[model samples]
Target: MSNADLPSHCDVLVVGAGPAGAACALWLARAGVDVVLVDQHDFPRDKVCGDGLIPDAHHALRRLGVYDEVMAAAEASRHVACIGPRGGRIDVPGTVAVLPRRELDDIVCRAAVRAGAKLRTPWRFEAAVVEGDVVVGARLKQGDVVRETRARWVVLATGAVPQALQAADMCKRRTPSGIALRGYVKNDAMVGRIKALEVVWHKSLTPGYGWIFPAPGGRFNIGVGIAHSHPARDGEPAKMKDVNLRKVFEAFCAHYEPARELMRTGTLEGDLKGAPLRCSLAGARYSRPGLLVTGEAAGSTYSFTGEGIGKAYETGLLAAETLLAAPGGVPAGTADDVRTRYEAALAALQPRFDLYERANRVNAHPWLADLLIWRARKSERLLRRMAGVLEETSNPGNLVSVRGIVRVLFPGA
Candidate 1:
């Protein structure tokens, strides 16, 4: 559909119909708000991702009322195995699942539509419509035609890609914090053997890790990630452009015996695909006058594990809540209140992000990872606690607490 055929105004215009946008639109629509969700791609489109959903992501899906659907359609696993440097491995028990973005995103977007949100697919967001420092709406491109849709509030859920943000002059920094590559492989041998989500840490891939997640139909989602700001062996800063992620992934698969064995009977589904991961480590601005940024656009991905789905869903929910609570659907005078509440909500969620950022630093040290993994293997208490963190039931900071550290240092204690 062309922009000319679309509504000229909406109560809220959400750009990028991914997890964050869909969740926000779903919540707002359920609250009787007039919301319109737009995306650059059509349904069933594939995004480069690890496909693994932790307990946090599952909870978000449940909030969106699609948990049962996802669970039924995706592969479930209760084990998470971490392979540290020198092959030191630790197995933690947790509830996790994997569903390809092609399916997962479609499910969530459909849920939003069903909840009364208008969805505009293949509608590319071109720029924000600002009326003297206040974002009033957005300009969307449909084919060769550009249309203007006005709204009291505009939410930016454009994940990773900075083009829209750049066009709006809202992007503060141009450099991405991390990069990752993923691909799918079909292997009959992996059906039973790979019952758990596995993450491997190699010395060569410091400040990054590789993962193998069990996908449906005996397939596997395998990938690797690295921080662009990773420190080099000579203690110099590493350049992201200089690093070859594909080559690194190939080397990682070849170096690990388990990865090699998994790929033995495996055939890649397609070419390897990659994307940039914008970690919310340095704290990106999440709101302005009338526009609010959510998801990876606001850098909500965890620095250590590169997990964004749950966080994106969270930011979406927060955005919806903020607008819903506003008087008369976010009036021009109340724009500052919206920005303040969103920023405060983001700050309240900062503790977890801070812990993960610290953990990322520790993960860069192979010796520390090896020691922690080796210790976690021998201590069921430590293992269970670690599992709790993955399940989002326990605080990650607890692992490094005085008592928690003592327990890890003295397993029998």
Candidate 2:
């Protein structure tokens, strides 16, 4: 269709076809709204992620009607293991699914298409075309072809790249910074024998941790992320550019006798991509006329484990529901009313997540790490309880409340 003769305008315009955007589109389209989903990258694009989806994330996919497809296409792991110094280990009985972002993105995007959302890959959002402080639509460019796509509302699912929504001016820094690095490698025999995802806490990498998530077909997603405000930052800080995760990878390989075989012919696919762990604790603003930000764009990522897929999924659904409710479209500042609904939902039962987020920001002593690891190893019940809290099925808030009371009474609990 010609730019002027654009076949149809949608009730909602979703920019960026990542998990958050695609999930929003899928939900809206299923509600029978005319939804347009666009992205700068084509189908099957790769994203840098830890690649493990907690059980609640699976529940989210079930809501979006892609759970079956996700199960079929992605690899699955049933638990997460914490490995500590001196080979102390703990296995928490939980289920986490895995998929390479390339395959998973394609599956979810296709699911949205199946639900009746128009998918436009390789379409770049140029700017928000506004009228009297209202976001009416967006100017889009595809391979030098400039055009316009108008909708009643616009949703930003653009992940960590915040420049796209600068026009909306509704975003703020929740945290000072976020940093991470991840890559894929062949799952060697040792990893194969150990069937759960492993999180290693080494004294040397305080305030940071390393992880090993096994994928289907004998492959693994392994990486580490550290809070940027470490005492180690003084002399020569390791910027995302300087960290050389590959060097870290080699160093990790040197320490793990079991991982040596896997590193023999290791190849780094792409440089590590960084995304901020935007918090809602300090409260960042969201939503404005003609524009609403979801996923990483809104900084909905959890501040603790740096896991955002679940938060992104929840916000994506909320963003769509809010748009549907606001037939007249989103309004500036007042957007918080809609945004608060989702935030409250997350906060009501997610206080432990917030507490963990606070803990992550604090300088983690090796003794604490050792204690946590020891706790994990000592009792499977505690590990399961902690994992349940992580999964969000159990009440993290209630758990935190009890802990707070205990600390108040004992002072060293």
> For each candidate, what TM-score against the reference?
0.93, 0.83
RMSD of each: 2.9, 4.9
Candidate 2 lDDT score at position 56? 66
- Candidate 1: residue pairs that collide: none
The candidate scoring highest on TM-score is: 1
> Against the unseen true structure, what C-alpha lDDT does each candidate score?
0.82, 0.67
Once fitted onto the true fold, the runs of candidate 2 whose alpha carbons sit more than 4 angstroms away are 1-8, 174-176, 188-191, 228-247, 265-284, 326-353, 361-363, 393-413
lDDT of 1 at 49: 84
lDDT of 2 at 187: 46
Residue 94 CA displacement from its true place in model 1, Å = 1.1
Q: For candidate 2, lDDT tens digit of each residue in 230-274?
A: 222565532443445455555566665545555465444455454
